[model samples]
Target: MTKKLFWEDPYLSTFTSSVISVEENENWPGKFLVVLDETGFYPEGGGQPWDEGNIGDGYVSYVFIKDGVIYHVVDQDPGKGAIQKCRIDWDRRFDFMQQHLGQHILSSVFEKHHNAETVGFHLGTETVTIDLTMDSISDEELQKVELEANNQIYKNLKVQSLFPSVEGLKELPLRKQPTTDEDIRIIEIKDYDYSPCGGTHPAYTGEVGMVKVRKWEKVRGNIRIEFACGLRALKDFIWKNQQINSISALLSLKDVEAYEGTERIYRELRDLNKKYNQQSRLLLEYQVKEYHREAEEYQGISLVSLVFEDKDMKQLQTLAAALNQYPNTVALLAAKGDKAQVVFTRSKDLSLDISKLFKEVIGLIDGKGGGNPITAQGGGDNVANLQGLMDAAVIKLKHEYVK
Candidate 1:
């Protein structure tokens, strides 16, 4: 088994260790796996990613543990060397440290106050998430949790990781029991949280900077809270502040009143849309009467054919249905726009297959559609030929069905 030096000193970035074994990774070509007698590189485990850096001259792309041995997957072979220097990317390592510790504090507060246990955790590239046992958490409750978590960071309490003896474990008030009995490592947040975790963490809670809960949603039977810590929290604030400022400027209101101003504008727009829809229905009724009056009679069938500019398909269907109310009437309507649309329908009294006639000419505009013998509608990208599409449908109806 390799000695996990990272557990000894989480802040350690560089170290010299003897190369225990070297082998070409079978899963990945052009990559070598080198095992060290001792390593400071943290392997990808416990919802945290692996540390990336260099071992000798080769770039260490990934680190992982297999059967008690930690292997550093490198871009190039470090050659057979007795001792090689290895380094972990400090920025990435420190970021994980902050996030991991922030989670400890945040989870402890939830379990402490709300009786919610952190069932799952994920340290993602941009954010960290914890799945709580509770299905729902109100905004007021979350606000209190966030404030308390930040308070823990402000306290700068000492965070200690130790392998406690069996007797020592029984005395401590742990948030949760350790999974293993032999080698139990507990992360104690000084007089506060005590949980079993093997991941790296800062020496003090203040090193976490801050913890911010971005949002939360119910997943499975639990609530998953998406939060950011340290520099991640700062970046999130910066972007959100910019967006709020932009919205306030657009609303012509103070930044604090932007939400109310947006709500007012949204309500006004919704009212206007409702009024517009009412006016549209009234106009369709008037047009239906005019279209039926102007229909051309063919073999006792009233063919109502017309075209409109930039019209909605729903409106076209409404107009077609209204015109078809008249006896022996067939409506062939098309709308010209970026995309062309056509709707064909016949009265219930008429035995013509309107869908068959519409399909034969829909391809002229590169469109597809189908419906019952009474009604059919479709649209296509060939906008310039929309009127021609309608003309063809009208002619096909007169030639094939009107007879």
Candidate 2:
């Protein structure tokens, strides 16, 4: 077992300890060794990240635990029985302290006000999460918890850690009973809260600065609460406000007026789309009128077909439907936009083999398309070959349907 200096003094970032043992473990590559220390270095466990810095001028790449022993994985192995100086990155260590302490206060508030238990906890790089036993906690309820937690922070309550015997714990009004009998380290926040936790925390609640609930959601019959503390919370607020200001400027509206401006723009776009559809329908009707007059009659069978420069699939289908209304008539329409779109339809008593014709015509243009027999559709990217496509459709009709 290693003496956790973080529990003794959370502010201690540098210490001197003798390396009692240094032996490489086979399970780890590059470097692996455990140190029997007198002081320093918070191990990576209990959901909080390990302290990062140097041990006796050697870089500590990873710090972890195995069977309650803290193992510092350094880039260069230090000789056994050597006295090494250790230093932790204070900024990162302090951030973990603030977040860990903030969680203690927030969890206490949930237990006090709603009888909820802190079932899970995770300390992340940007935020900290605490999972409560409650099935659902509304936004309003979460706000109440936030308000109370920050209020306690403002009060600057004294926080103390004490090891009490199993019999001694019976006298203290604990929030939850400890599962283990091994020296229970109870963290008491004045009159506010008392719980058994081995994780590092600040000496006073005020050191946590401000607690803000960033967001929350329900997970596995519990409410998972995400929050930030101290500088983290402050930074999040500043970034979010900057985003809102940018949105207001882009929309050309005040902060309060942005929503209404967006709604108005959406409505105007919908109305413009309706007008555009009506104009397209009128244009298609005129094209159909011209086709009726120009169609060629063969044995009482009128054939009106043309390949137009660059038109979409929808326009080609509309033209085919309009020309097919004439009895004993057949129309084959092909339009090449970024790609080619073709539609063919025949009136009663006229049958056109469109699938075979598309394979023959489109294949010459190095494209692929196919459709049904009486009415066939195909397309490709050979826009420059519109004339060829029109001539081919006419030839196929002459050979297959005109007879």
Top-TM-score candidate index: 1
The model with the greatest lDDT is 1
| Candidate 1 C-alpha error for residue 52, in Å | 2.1
Clashes of each: 0, 1
For residues 1-403, what per-residue lDDT tens digits would candidate 2 score against the true structure? 8777878997898888888787777766777475857556788876788887787877886787776678888777777888878888888888998998899899999999999999899998877999999888777888999999999999999999989887788988898777677857898999988888777788899999999998889899888999999999999999988887887899988988877887898899999999998997888788887887788876677778787775778778878877777788788787767877777778756565656666677765557766676677776776777668778878777877566
Q: List RMSD in Å for every model shown.
A: 2.4, 5.3
- Scored by Cα lDDT, where does model 2 land? 0.82
Backbone clashes in model 2, listed as residue pairs: 310-336
Model 1, position 345, has a per-residue lDDT of 90
Candidate 1 lDDT score at position 241: 97
- Taking the tens digit of each residue's C-alpha lDDT, what string does model 1 give over 44-135? 99899999999988899889998889999998777766688888899999999999999999999999999999999999778799999997
